[model samples]
Target: MSIWRSYPRSLKVLLLAMLVNSTGMAFLWPLHTIYITQGMGKTLSEAGFVMMLHSAAEIIGSFLGGYLYDRIRGKRTLLLAVLSSACFIFIISIGLSWPVYILMMILLGLGIGTIFPPIYALAGSIWKEGGRKSFNLIYLVLNFGVAIGTALGGIVAQFSFQYVFWVNGFTYLLFIFIVWRALDEPDPVYEAAQKKALDPRPKKEFRPLQSFYSLLILCLGFMFCWVTYIQWQTSISTYIHLLGFPLSSYSALWTINGLLILLGQPLLQWFMDRVKSPVKWQLLSGVIFFILTFALLSQNQSYGGFVTGMVIMTIGEILIFPAVPAIADRLAPLDRRGMYQGLVSGAANVGRTIGPLLGGLLFDGFGPLVLLYSCIFICGFALICFGTYQRLQYIQKEVSTVKVNK
Candidate 1:
């Protein structure tokens, strides 16, 4: 309670909205592919393709949302996104049939995708000094929503999946209302940056292309990270179901995953604060966790093994996800902040789009072992890319310092 009020007023409001949005979203994500495969009478490959489409829409939405963040510079952009999400979700509640549901999923993806970057940008806007803390808090509460929603969703699903639809829709309605009323405040930093853009003299000296290159490498690595990460939702979830576990059991793993994140964030934050270069440690430690988790999956036969892998993966997630946007914030020039954040987000979605499609094909053509091995390989590649990006950043900084001294 005291901690809630300690944040900027806008940050507090946004966290609540994040909570609602995540809760609603959690109800669907764990079920998406399974619903298409088992309930809709679609094949696993078809389900993967549908999930890919959802992520593809998200990639478009993310970049567009970033552009709007720079252009519109207020809560209206957010309102538009939430409104679109709610509308699509409402249509989904009316009918859970085949092609209609797929269309709704893709539209909902666009709407949902549109919401993230602006929210992230707004977090950076409201909490300037403690920017990392703001992103972590938002992420922490987002998982609270996931933990609560998945726990309840697992139980509710025992009776009717339709009820899940209605409840998720209701949460979105609540999110829309909250964003409309409480989140209308202008972001001071964003406004200042927009005004500064009018005079090109100062910004012209800064190497925008160098900044872009750094972001491109960082996002490319991060995208592979997501590609490997999301197999839990797509391939792994379907794999669990095929083993004859009920949806409740499959969903419980998510409940556990969310709960573990809740426990992990604070402890990890304490440790991160002690490190000199937290971002470097984040990527280094994250790829190790990635390697280990995928290896576990290749041999995993029990729920308990999945549980252990999920906990390790959650630790890696805490190290990585909240920091990615913050790193982009550090890399971006004032004028390009929104676009950099958007591109990072877009890269993540692109990874999500490709992950399940590739995983499904691998699982169908070869086996789960093949998919797991491929993810491990990609994680190795991500590590090399991230390390190179960091070295490049160091060079960029040295060049800038020498220029300033002259």
Candidate 2:
């Protein structure tokens, strides 16, 4: 209670808003593949195509949202995002047909995409003293919403998916109200910080380009990470349903995935406290867990095996999600923070756009063995990308240090 209350107004509101929005968002996604496959009688490949378009729109929104955050600095961008998303949710609840549903999904993706980067930038702006704690708390609240929403969503979906739509729209309505009431004010401290977190040229001590280049490298690896991570949401769900598990079982796994993150926050904080270079170690160690997840999945056919894989994957997710944005905050100048944050979201959206389409194609052409093998390769490749970025960063710092001495 004290800890939550200690956060700045903007931070607290962001957390609450995300939790509220995610409660509704959670109800929509897990059922997406199932709804398309079972309810609409569509093929997985077709569903993947629709999801690809949705993700592409999300990428557009990410860039737009970033642009807006940098130019305009308050609730207006967020309100636009949430309000549009609410409209989509409401429309989708009313009608869930073929082309209309797909179009609305793309619109919904854009709306949701528009909402994120500003809040992330807000965390840095509003809670300067808390460092990564601000972002991590947001991530934690996001999954906390996931845990509760998925658990209930699964049960609600068991009755009628129409109910899922209604409830989701209701939550979005709530989200709109929260954003309006809480985020309407502007703070100049946050405004100045939003322009440039640090002076890039401090007596030739730092390269002006370091922060931007660092963000680029980070975005590249993070993109691949999402490419791998998203398969669990899209193709993996389809794969599970194909294996004869109930739809409820498919959603139950997400419930478990969320539940672990909620419970493991304490242990993760403890682990972070003991670590040396948290960002690098967390990246490397978490990808290793991702490797382990694909390795486990490649052979296992049982629900228990999937359950075990979800647990391991959630560990990886916990380590990675909050850390990436926090690292971005460090690497960004005030002027580019929103752009950097948007790029991170853009990368993830790109991955999300591609992961399902490619995974679906791979699954359709090759067997599950091949799909699983491909993920192993993807995860390994992401490891290489991030590892190489770390090396390049070291080289850049060394070169800069040499220049400073001269």
Query: Tens digit of lDDT per residue, candidate 2, span 1-406?
Result: 8976787887777788889988888888878777778878999778767877887899999988888887775477888888888789788877577989999999988988988888788787776667778888888898888777876887898998889988988888888788888764446665565434543344333543766676777788888788889899778988998999998898788778877888897678667867655577788888889989989999898999999999999899888888888878776666676787898889888988788778878988996788888988888777876776656556778897888799
State the lDDT of candidate 1 residue by residue for 46-119, as single tens digits.
88678778888999999988888778753777888888887887787676778888889899888888888888
Give each model's whole-structure lDDT. Answer: 0.81, 0.81
RMSD, model 1, all Cα superposed? Answer: 3.8
Each model's TM-score? Answer: 0.86, 0.87
List where candidate 1 sits over 4 angstroms from the true fold.
Answer: 33-46, 96-100, 154-162, 184-204, 237-252, 296-304, 397-406
Error of 2 at 350 (Å): 1.5
In model 2, where do residues sit more than 4 Å from their true spots? 32-46, 94-102, 154-166, 184-208, 238-249, 299-302, 390-393
